[model samples]
Target chain A: MQYAIIGAGPAGVIAAETLRKTDPQGSIVLIGGEPEPPYSRMAIPYLLIERIPETGTYLRHSPDHFQKQGIEIRQDRVTAMDTPNRRLTLSSGDGLQYDRLLIATGSRPIKLPVPGIDLPGVHNCWTLEDARHILRLAQPGAKVVLIGAGFIGCIILEALAERGVDLSVVEMGDRMVPRMMNQTAGNLIKRWCEAKGIQVHTATRVKGIESRSGPGFLKRVTGVLGLDAESGSANALGVELDNGHRLQADLVISATGVQPNSEFLKGSSVELEQGILVDNRLRTNIPEIFAAGDVAQGRDFSTGGHQVHAIQPTASDHGRVAALNMAGTDTLFQGSFNMNVLDTLGLISSSFGLWMGVEGGDSVEICSPEKYRYLNLEFQEDVMVGATSLGLTQHVGVLRGLIQGRVKLGQWKDRLKRDPSRLMEAYLAQNAVL
Target chain B: MQRSLHIDPEKCTGCLQCEMACSLENEKVFNIAKSRIKVFTFHEEGRFVPYTCTQCDEAWCMHACPVEAIQLNKLTGAKVVNESVCVGCKVCTIACPFGTVNYNEDSGKVIKCDLCGGDPECAKACPTSAIAYIDANWTGLDRMRSWAARTDTSARA
Candidate 1:
């Protein structure tokens, strides 16, 4: 049997390794688009902070690890896939046949259509190439304007801050990480960043980017006179804001969001919603084809409805389950729980499952914004459906345990309603009873 | 036969020798904070329970690792972290349900119990046989035998 996996990210790599272990005789081909080795985009932040070298971003360190396992690694990308013919065409003009295919093609950053976005100094911190460009311009004291304040953006914020760049963050939403965090929690993060000497602008939008016209005569004259250090270097970008303010930026990082890289599946007859729709088995509507990672919109643990969880944990879990089924193990995928744990300038915040609280559901909150400590619980009857916490890192897994285990709180629910900090006690009590 | 570290929480006296041994063995430090095995104190209940990586058959940390840094040692059945390749993403720390896998901020990598490559120091240092290195396949055999002894009428007399 021949297994072809596209997009050599975590999901695709894991699936290839799993297939090798499950069916030793099967031929596997893992395809990646980048020229470099299969690496994790999640490690880009660490790379930016100089925590690790380029080799550290690799999904596998050994140069011949895949070759040793007899799994062929191809650096070409899929141009088009003919699902009916069980074949795929590569960008390098190569064609391949396969018995099973996995679309782990992940997602790409959304490029805003504004003018001057394609300029050299502007980049999306999505790939290794992008990180190299960022490092060249994001030097200490460099004026950097970050486009979004979401999860990915916040991570980039930490790296940029660590690099000692004069950073300014602009968010379109009312608060930071608007999708992953609530208002009070998000604003607290903004305040924390502000305290750490980073300028944060919320409820704002970047109108457009305009390149500073080639140094004017006076500026050129100043450069010749050795008065203006940055003059005659024509790469400075002017970021126009909706609020009628313009900020001069040496580097502009666009981290607005990402969309599934499923454009190639336009007429493939494989289902596509927000992403490629897959069942609990990670199988697409097409029988021989499957999807995983950010490209797969599988089941949500709390809602039980199909949703795209583009997190690392979900990607790895989907890969293993999909590979088992691909290898004829007949495994069922447990739905992914929606969770986000973030650290912004030393303040840790996390949210799990239906943290926003369902309609008509009972909710409790303890917000000590002054101390940057917050805990909120959402409940449907007696069971805790979701939880969010800031600065409460001890035994945080108990929140996950209670939600994932679907443990009934019984009378303990009332005690928790009075004090949500008793999560450890509640978890231990439930474990003891069980 | 593969061996596994088994912990009987009841036998624990909360002495924390296992923690000291684990930290010293893996991190070359006496600092309990650096220990792979942690002893949680239940001050109100006057009990302590020691916990670490179970080295599960399908270890979540191994699969969750984007890089193949966590690999299984065939002889010991221990999943060990190759720190050189680790990018310190901390994804495994969240993926682990038992929370045994943890991030080491100093090294910018993760650390977990590797059973000391089959010669577990925690089991050796436990003054009270609270932790034992036993056969992996028969982890429950001792408990089953004890129940059998309880039901034996000949011994009861």
Candidate 2:
């Protein structure tokens, strides 16, 4: 049996490892689009912050980790797949046959439809190569303007701040990390970034990027002539916003968001929603092929339907579950929990399950915007279905415990409705685990 | 069901024996920093809260772990971290809203209460019976029994 996995991100690497463990000599071939080793995108921020070297981003530290496992690590992208024949056509114009194929191709950062979005000095902090380019331009005292204040953008914003760059963030959303966090939490995070010397503009949009001439034009002339342009072009870029505000920037980083990298799977027999649609077992409509990672829209626990959870943890879990089923172990995926934990700057916050609260569901919230502390709990019937908290880490897992266990809060449910801080006591008293 | 650790904060004496025993049992050292179970001291309130990993069936730590470094031991039902496999990204630390999963910089791995591979040393070392390893199914029985006893007013009469 031959197993071919696409995209050497966390999902691809883990799926390869799991397949090898299940079927040791199955002729496993791991394919990566990038030239580098299978590295975690989560480590890119650490790379930018100088926490680790380029090699540290490699998924397996040992020089021959994959080779030792007899897994062929191919640094080539999959242009398309032929499901009926169970073969993948590579970008290098080669075809490889496999009994099973796992599409672990993750997503790519979304570049906005604005002018000068692709100009030099503008980069997306998604890949290692992007990190290398960012490291060169994000010098200290360099004016950096970041687009989008979402999760990816905020994390990159933190790293840029650490590099001592004069940073300004523009978010089209009303607050930061809009999708992951609610309004209260989002606005609080924006304020937290502002406190950290980051100028955050909420509910803002970039109209266009204008390349300014003057010293910058002369510098670019010298730069194109193979001479050091130096700081001349550094101040040559200007960002115009819909709010009639113009800001000068040396570098612009786009962190708007990402879309599933399932474009190559287009026109294939495999199904595609916002992502590649997979059943609970991570199997596509064609049993020979499967998809995981951000590309697979699996089960969403909160809604009991399919949704694309593009988080890292989901990618890793999907890889393992998909590999197991692919190996004929007949394992079933238990669906994904809506778990999101964010550490904006230094403040830690998390939201689990149906965080936005269910319709006709009872809810409770305690907000102290002054202290940057908030707790919002959502309950359906007697069960706590979701919770969101900020500035409190101690005993927060109890919220998840209650939800996962479906622990009947019993009489303590009323107590929680009164003072939600007593969740720990309720968890202990109910002491339920499912 | 496997046995689970039952903690009673009222019975705790603010002792550090659990920490010492935990560190010594797992790491073979006397360093409290290496201990998985932590006791938070609320000096102003004169209360000490001892906390450890609950090892939930679908643990967030296990789910959030990108490397599958955190696994569930079917026998003990404890979520154990495979140190060798862990990249020490500390995502589990943040994923754990309770803050039980902590990072050890020396090993570049996140350490959590593994219940000492089934036989927990903290329960054995507790002098005041603050921490007890009991049947997992019946940890809640005592609370339920107490509530039931309250419903029986004949005993009070």
Candidate 3:
């Protein structure tokens, strides 16, 4: 049998590798839009900030290594797919037939719909190219304005601040990382950013960007207009107010968020709601064609509803399920656990599982501003459902397992809040089969 | 003998250890989004470049800073941002050509690399030695050595 994987990202690569292992005689074609080999997307921020070297980002396998495994990697974008014909047309105008197809196109950054957004200084942090451009624009003492207070935005903020770049973050939400963390956790991060001299403007909406234009060149960001929260009115550039104000910046980066890159399948028969819809078996409505990674929408582990797009681990898991079924092996995609580990400014914050909407759930909150530590745990019916920790994230693995496994609290219920390690040990001992 | 952190982008793997170390040392968080050193990746080119304040002898951020919030740390040769006196006017942010300086909305003050009081945590934390503290005058020594090695006939001939 032959397998064709569209995308050389984590999901596609894993799927190809898994298929190769399952069927050594099978032919595999790995198509990727990125010119380089598959690498970690999560590591892009660190690469931009000079934490790790470029060589370290490359996958363990080289192009030749894939060839040895009988996996053909074609570096080109798939413009269209004829699912009925069992063939694909690439941007390079090549056609290939496949017994089975896996679509793992991943995601593209969401662009802001503001005027002058197409200006030279505006950038979206999605690909390595975006990182390069953003870095090139960053100089000593340059004014930088970041739109979006999400993970990417916050990561860029931390990196730039360390480089001596004056940075400003404009978040539409009332708190930083609202989607990932609750107000309480958000407040802790906000305080940390403030302490580091990084200005964070929340609950403010950006109206448009003003660029300095005139001559042949020298186009730089003059100011940003937005609504101030306190005054509830339009604010001018450089005018400081509670809600909004104009910020003059040399470069403007939009780390807002990303949407699944499923635009190519617009005319196709694949079901899509933000992303390609897949069943628990990781198969799309169309038989033979499978979708995974950011492009594939699957059931949420916590909510058990159709949710589009998860992080890297989820994408990898999706790839495994898709590959197993493709290789004639029966496998079901369980689901994904929503987790976030963010270290913003001086605050290390991590959250796992469902920490929201437990009306009468048993809860424990620990806050120590002087020590810069905060911990919050929520339990439902004597079972660990979700947890949040700031500054000290040593017990993340223990918490993650408890939430993922839905382990019984039983006698260790009281010890859960006070000593996470001890409670984890006792729980493991009880669960360990003699 | 003032030294600045030198970055070799080719060595960067994008682990973000530098960002974590810098934030922990300065802001006490693992937030890479607010770090002083920034990394840029050219995905198509398969290149990762870490960028930060070069701490030029004639620093524009220091001169353009209206309230003098940006000052040159004579000991470390870093253009440091003083949070206490900073008015958050962002004049220095616009003046710099490289767009390194930024305004912090949370603190209402501008932030920049202060060289971690001379022992730069970013350089130390870089696992791959992508970032290093080298002699300011001999920053190009690595390139020189590479060229010199290429001239040797032992391997080529």
Candidate 4:
């Protein structure tokens, strides 16, 4: 059978490999817009900071491995899909027919519509090329302006700050990582960043940018316009406000977030709501077509609703599910847990499952500001649903399993609220004996 | 001789063990997002680079601190942030060429690498030996040795 896969990312690469393992005789053509081989996008920041060497981020399998598995990888972009003709047109003007096709276009960074955003130093960290460009501009003492106080933005702050760069963060929301973290956790992080000398501005909007002309080009960021919350007025570069003032930066990075890269399928038959809608079996509306990764909006097992999970683990699992169905095997993707692990200046925070739900849920918190330890857990109907931990991550594995396995809390529910560590030990001991 | 943390980026896998260890030691949480040491990745280049405060001999953070909240520990050669004395003016944060020193709003103080009071947890928890505590004087010994090995004249002879 002829199999054509768009995107050579983790999802597409894994799907091709799985298909080769299941059906060795099948003809597979893997197409990707990126010129290089498949690499981990999550590790891009480390590469910029010189924490890990370039070759360390390469995928487990070499290029020869794919060749040995009878797979052909074409480093090109997929321009259009002719479902009726069962063929795909490439940007190189090449057409290939296939019995089955996988749409794993993945995601692109969400760009803001503000003026001066298209300037030279503005960047969005998504692709490898984007990382390289950012690295080139990130010199020691370079002033940086980061928009959006989300996970990516915070992580970048930690990395760039170490490199001796002048950095400032602007968040439109009242709190950092407003979507993923609660106000309490956000406050803690805000405190931590401030303690480290990173200036964080919350509840501020960037109206526009001012460019200064140099000998042959624009020298630097002349000014930035934003409204201060306290004064409720426009603030220019070094804008004086009731609270403080705003400053200018050399480079501006927008970690605003990302959306599914489904633009290629705009006129296609594939249905999309944020991403390509996929069934439990990972099949798209088109019978022969399938979607996975950030591009595929699958069911959230915990919520039982369709959502785009942009986590690495989910994208890999989506690939496996799509592969199983493509190989004529019946298998279902159970969905993903909303798990996030963040590493900031000197804090480690991780949360899983339904972190925020309806009120009246049993909540347990252990905080020791003197020791800088904080932990919170939320339970609904006597079951572990959401949990957050700082400093203590050894408990994450057990807690994650308990939530994922849907184990009965029973008598342990009360014990957990009182003494979680002891309860976790008891649960682990019981599991070991069983 | 005092020792400093040596980093070998090639050995790093971006597991964030150093970040976790740092945060846990300083903040008592396993959140990498709060760790002092950060790992940056250049995806297209297939690299992972871990960066942190180099603990300069001059120590700009310590000197720039208006209230003298930043102090250098003689034994550990680390600049420690004193929360009690700090007023959160953020003068040191701007003064430090490397943006290592930062302000924490929760405690109204500044935070930086304290070397974990001599036993740095980041170096200890590094799984791949990417970050290691070694003699400060011989920080360039490893690089020199590698280059010296490449200069062998046996091939020409």
Quote model 4's TM-score: 0.69
Model 3 chain A: weakest 10-residue lDDT segment is: A228-237
Top candidate, metric TM-score: 1
List per-model TM-scores for chain B.
Answer: 0.86, 0.85, 0.85, 0.85
Better of 1 and 4 by lDDT: 1
Q: Which window of 10 residues has the lowest lDDT sum in candidate 2 chain A?
A: A425-434
Q: What is the lDDT of residue A165 in candidate 3?
A: 79
* Stretches of candidate 2 exceeding 4 Å from the true structure: A214-220, A224-232, A432-434, B1-51, B54-63, B67-90, B94-99, B102-111, B114-125, B129-157
Q: Give the docking tier of candidate 1.
A: incorrect
Residue A140, model 1: Cα distance from true site in angstroms: 1.3
Model 4 chain B poorest 10 in a row by lDDT: B148-157
**DockQ-best of 2 and 4:** 2
Off by over 4 Å in 4: A61-63, A214-246, A429-434, B1-157
State every prediction's TM-score relative to the real structure: 0.88, 0.84, 0.68, 0.69
Model 4 interface DockQ: 0.02
Q: What is the C-alpha lDDT of each candidate?
A: 0.82, 0.79, 0.69, 0.69
What fraction of the reference structure's interface contacts does model 2 contain?
A: 0.13
Runs in model 1 deviating more than 4 A are A214-235, A363-371, A392-395, A410-425, A432-434, B15-17, B20-35, B41-47, B119-121, B137-157
